[model samples]
Each structure stands twice: as C-alpha cells, then as structure tokens.
Target: MGLEIRLLTARDTEAYWHLRLEALEREPKSFGESAGEHRLSTPESATERLTTNPEDNFVFGALLDGDLAGMAGFFRYTIAKERHKGKIWGVYVREDCRGKGIGRALLAALLEKIKACPGVEQVSLTVAAGQSAARALYVSLGFKTYGLEPGGMKVGDEYLDNEHMMLKI
Candidate 1:
C-alpha cells in the first residue's frame, strides 16, 4: 500500500476529532479514553487537544484515498525523571482499512518520528492481552513484552488484561 502518512496539527482538528470518536466508539477497549469523555469536548476544545507540542507530542495519520484512515500518537513522558522514555499511544486503523499494512505503516512512521526526538532512548505501549495480531505486529517491530497487567482495563463487568511492551530504540 502506497499510504501517505502525515503528521497532524491543529489545522486537522475536525478530521481528527471525527476519526478519533469513530475509533473510540468502534473499539472501546483498544483505547484508554472513552467516547463519553471526548463527547464533552467542543470543537474549540478539540483545537486545544489536537494542537500539541510538535517536538514531543503529535499524531501520525495514515491517509488512503485522501481520507484519514488511521492514526497513532507519540508523546514524551511528562515527569522530569522519565524524560528519556517516550510512549506510543492511540494506535488504530479503520475497520475497512485493516489488513492492508496501514496500521504497520502508521507505527513505522511513528517510530521514525520518535527517532528524531533526542534523548528518547526507549518507547513503550500497551495492548489488550487477547489482541494477538496487534501484539505480533509490535513484536515484529522489535517491541518486547516486559509485563502484563492482569485486569488492567475494566469494561462493564468484565476485565481485560493488558500487555506492556517496550522497544529499546
């Protein structure tokens, strides 16, 4: 897939908001933020949310046919002592766009961007434990499973385990 990956900014707020809401509603457990929380945000607030520090925080969008097909976000740990560690979050591709290497390409592009940030020695991300395909994709990209948080995420009455993975970039 000759996917066009772009780093989004404040100007892309509308598209980002819609796509993010879709991802959250479609796959709730895959994300930490709930759609309800995001629904509380107005377009004005979305501008603030979408506009982030370019050097340490940003989102990568995978565009196929000129549409926002997928997205992934990267951010540096905010704590002073954890400045060397970065995090990859909010990785999701549209259902129709899945299995086309879009997700993989988005991640690859995100890693490439993370590489440009000095002092970022390692990157970390977490996935639901049962998502084998996502886990395999991360592993193939050189991420190792460091730990598993049992019942890390609770969805209604059931709890889902989360796998913590890290890449020594």
Candidate 2:
C-alpha cells in the first residue's frame, strides 16, 4: 500500500513532536538548528506549533501504515506587503523512509493547503545547496530557484549554503 497523507490536528501534537525531535536530532543539517535547542522548549511550545491556526499556517503529515513518516508546514506572512506569500518550514522525513515519495506527498499536501489560504499567492522554502534530490523534488513540483544564501547556516564548525526556492500558487 502507499503512504497516507493528511493535514495534522491538535490531537497529533505528541506524535508530531516526537518525529520533529527525531528529525532535528538525526539530521540537524537538514534544518536550521539542533534538537538540543528545542529540548529547552516547554511542552507548551511544541503543542503551540502543532496547534497553530490553520488559517495562518497548516501542517501536513505523511503516514506509512499509520506511522508518521514525514511532515511539513507553512507560515503565512502577516505583514501587509508580504501577505501574499507563505514561508514553508518544518519539513522532515525519516532517513529510512525517504526516496519513496513521502517528502513529495507532504509538500504537495501543504502546498495545496497554503494555496487555499486567503492572500497566499506564493510559497517559499530553503534547501541545502548540495541536496540535489531535494532541489529536484521542489523544482519538479513547480518551485524555482530564486537565490542562494552563502553560508546560510552553521552546523558545528562547518557552514552550509542554502538555495531559496518559490512556487507561485
């Protein structure tokens, strides 16, 4: 059977936090910071993110046989000038579950969700420069490279570049 993709709700908070921390711990380079940083956050913080208003942001998950395998979400800009855009973040997939389209499923679901939000005309995301598979996946789904941020993130003693990508909704 194929993976099941759906929009997450408040009831998913615990599972969402578990998988999110797992991603941050196992693949720190894939995201902006380390799980250790979030470890300092209170349970309220995790629940708040998972329960964010769907009108402003929506989180989607891809479950493989009822197990959360991947997740992604978007935060719509609040500024009047940028209200037409949304920033995609919190993207992750288990290392062992990647390449099977879970990432694509999560992205696609979140994309549709954002596209339906009021005033959201575009969606943007950042991917590591060397992650060709991720870049290709985004490009194939209609995102285009808008720019590159050199040394955008520091992982321990190393710096990594990131590519800014956007898709018009």
Candidate 3:
C-alpha cells in the first residue's frame, strides 16, 4: 500500500482528538499525560483547536491501507525570543503501526513544513527519555538531544524523565 501525507482540516477535528487521546492513553509512559488527563476538554475545545491554526500550525497524517496510522504537528514558536523555531508535538503512531516507517514519514512531512516556514531555523521536541525507538528515529532524522529535565512529568504513579531535542534546519 502507498503512504499518503495530508494536511488536517476542520473536518478532521474529532479524528484528530481521538487519535491524540488514543496515543496519550495507549502510550502513557511515552507521553506527557495519563489516560484520564484529557477528559477535561470538551468538544468545543477540540473544534477550537482544530480551527484556530489549521494552516500555520500543520498536522500531517499518514494513511496506511486506507487508515490513518500516524500523525505529527508543529506550531510556530510565537514568542519573540523563539520566533526562529517551531515546537513539535502530538507525534505518535498507532501501536500496531510502529516500526513500519510510518512514524518516519509523519515526522519527515512535518519537518518539511517547518523548513518552509520563513525564519524558522529549527524544530524542537521533547521525548520520553526511555523511548529509545523514538529517540533513534529522531537521531536518524538529524535531531540531537540538547539537555534533560528531571521528573518532567508524572504519568499516573510514575514520574518520567524528558529529553529535550532539537533539529536545526
């Protein structure tokens, strides 16, 4: 099957929210949140998020066998101190779809969009320190760990370390 990458639209609000919450729930250790954390958001929140910046903040999704198995997004760093960079987030592939190059495709597509952003010189993301597979993929894509944060997040009963990484374009 062929892999297709496309921009997320208003029509994808529910799917986007569902897939992201699924990722956060399924891989609680790899993400910043626990399964129950996202319950605070209402459908309005999801729609607002989807509609606010569909064009500037890009979300690239990968379809495998007619199903969307992975997604990644990046938002331009709007602060004056970090205007030359974008922060990547919501990067995840379905559990059954991992290791099949879908994650790579999703990340590459997001990076390409980031590179096209005027004045965007780098992309930054924080990954769970113990996620070696994701870390290796970032390295292969030219991302380097810049530093580490201790007890960055508490997922359920465990505190996880976070590795800050960046890719200079």
User: Quick one: best TM-score, which candidate?
Assistant: 1
Using TM-score as the yardstick, the better of models 1 and 2 is 1
Worst 10 residues of 1 by lDDT: 45-54
lDDT of 2 by residue, 61-163 (tens): 8888888888998888888998898899888888889888788888878877787787788889999867777778888999998999999989999999999
lDDT of 3: 0.81
**TM-score against native, each model:** 0.94, 0.93, 0.91
CA lDDT of every candidate: 0.87, 0.84, 0.81
lDDT of 3 by residue, 73-129 (tens): 888867899888888888898888788888888887888878888888888899986
TM-score, prediction 3: 0.91
Clashing pairs in 3: none
Give the lDDT ranking, best first: 1, 2, 3
Error of 1 at 63 (Å): 1.0
lDDT tens per residue, model 1, 1-169: 5579999878888888999899889888787788998888898876765575678988999988778999998889879899999989889899998998998989989999899899999999999967777888999999998999999998778799999999998
Alpha-carbon error at 29 in model 3, in Å? 1.3
